[model samples]
Target: MVNLKLKLSEKANYLAFLIVFVSLGLASQSILAEEVHEPAEQIAPHQEQFEAGKFVIEHVSDAFEWHILTYKQHHISIPLPIILYSNNSGLNIFWSSKFEHGHASYHNFRIEEEGEHAGKIVELNEAGAVVGLPIDLSITKTVAGIFISVFILIFIFLKVAKSATSSTGRAPTGIQNLLEPIILFIRDEVALPTLGKDKSERFLPYLLTLFFFILIENLVGLIPIFPFGANVTGNIGVTMVLALFTFVITTFSGNKHYWKEIYNPDVPWWLKYPLPLMPIVELTGVFTKPFVLMVRLFANMMAGHMIVTVFVSLIFIFGQIGGPALGGAVSPVSIAFSVFILLLDVLVSFIQAYVFTLLSALYFGMATSDHH
Candidate 1:
């Protein structure tokens, strides 16, 4: 009996130690998982919405259709989707097509065919044209906003410019008072420094217009709602068109001196002649310069937006399965980084606009300069 009692006591002690070891293992695992899982989950929300927004921008047609059949069906249409989040409901998805004006029950439609949902595979009629066009009233809203913004800026500036020339040498009043300093700065600092007093005045109108237009558009894109978030400057086509205008203006404004410099550059004899290849290479540089301008602005703007979106997405992906503890751990980090990027984006907005305008003015100055 004594031996049996001793054996039982030993067994109980062993079991207690085993429980402690198992509990320690699980506790460590939970800690590690929380650390690893938090950031990914925190970023998920930003990622999901950003990708969804980018997809919509890439696929959604801006072309307006007057009638249902007259709809220009270049690509398949998915019902207009929106991402909604609030403290009360968490996250919700809504389709604009599902809701009717003043009606309560939402009628949502899903894509029956693969192309329709994914925005691929256009259907063409016998005349080899698109069968139907997606109704794009959204674009009109965007256009209206752009027009209003442009009109306001232009009207205000034109008034300011006119005031600067008016009877009294004293500064203008009202909106003119607000904008006078910026205009003078552009003229004195940007233009005079780079293009000189004589040539700078000639290009001032275009430089100011470009700068203000881009600045407003970049700010508007940050709104992240309907009639906004159109990625105006980030759109390659828009940048290309703007670049083309600059190219045309520069080309037409080019004096005999500009052409002489390109065709007969003042270089070392070896480089100027270069057997036969130097002329060809030198000529190519002229075209390549404006092309670089188009690509640089578009790429920088698009890339910054994409990176911010990716970081924000980590929250959504990890949070879905992580529950509270893991999600909470990651949210702060993701939000912090997103805020950092947002601040950087603000600087980038101005920098990019300034660079584009500055380079354009530089080109114009060179084009119109008198021969040495």
Candidate 2:
């Protein structure tokens, strides 16, 4: 009797399972039918919506305005000045808002939305062809960052200088108290070791300025806020300018021994006279040094910003593919890694700045080194 009852219960459970299985199959079939009936245009819109890489590129690249954040369908951004000059246009000055965030053209000029010129201001003809290159000396996001950094540096140093003068023989106080140790460290620890005590004094001001500028720019980049965090150090143009300064200083300051080592390196006589291999190699090293400096700082800073952005993007990527539950599950892991990298990036910021300044000083030492 117990076996008979168990058999009956198993039959009932099987029947209930079949009903659910059939229901799901029918529901899926209906969904498929509806999708087939829908027009291609309807599906095309969905395909355009999930673009992760685009988001990454847009965030890192320089823009005319500063995009703060997006809420729902509205984008909040600070408009910057758009200064353009062309043979035809003469000088067209306007706010970036005139372009409506790249949605419309203004005065026969539009920010290129696609292609190689994307994100750049170009003059357009009646036929919509790019007619001329506009000199875009406008104050862009990166430029704004530079201005802010310069202002801050000037303000801080000026305040400290005033305090030192006013205090006279008394102990240092306020901003002077804070900056004194750092300035001393760069002088005694960095410059003295690399350029020696006597020579370091002459270049101490420039070295100090270089170190502080890089350090401040790096710190500001990690903020991820408005009116700041413009990736100034990451921009190749800015890095190139910094490297050029080092190169110029090293070239002008090079002594007899320095040029002698390059043009007449202590190598096999055959290498110098016949092939001029040693001299050629040494001469090549001169340009390569600054090239390395430019590439190193630019690559490191840009890479850090890209990595942090990619990690944060993972959450949205998961949500798009696997629904909200999967996104929620991935959030903790993504945020954890991002935070860890951010902390490491802070350390990198100091290290990069020190490395740059230290290298510059070393080059200076080598350039001015006295040889018997």
Identify the leading candidate in terms of lDDT. 2
Q: Mind giving the per-residue lDDT tens digits that candidate 1 earns over 1-372? A: 222222322332333233223322211110000011122323334423225455334422232111111122122222333333333334445543332211222222222223443432222344544444333223222243344445445555445545545625564577657655655566677878878877775667666667776776676665555445556677675577667767888999999888887887777778775464566676897798789989998898787667666666666545666855776788888789877887887889889888888888888888887887
| C-alpha lDDT score of every prediction, in listed order | 0.55, 0.76
Q: How close to the true structure is residue 101 of candidate 2, measured as C-alpha lDDT?
A: 73
- Per-residue alpha-carbon lDDT of model 2 for 1-372, expressed as tens digits? 222222322332333233223322211110000001222333343334557788888788788877777554456777777778888869887777777778778998999988888778889998888986787767777777776666666666666666776777778888778767777777778889989877976766667767877887998888887657889889898788778878999999999999999999888799888789999999999999999999999999999988988998999899888988998999999999999988898999989988898899999999998896
Candidate 2 ranges beyond 4 A from true positions: 1-48, 168-174
Residue 145 accuracy (lDDT) in model 2: 75
Model 2 lDDT, residue 125, Cα: 92
Judged by whole-model lDDT over C-alpha atoms, candidate 1 comes out at 0.55
- Kindly give the stretch of ten consecutive residues in candidate 2 with the minimal lDDT sum: 27-36
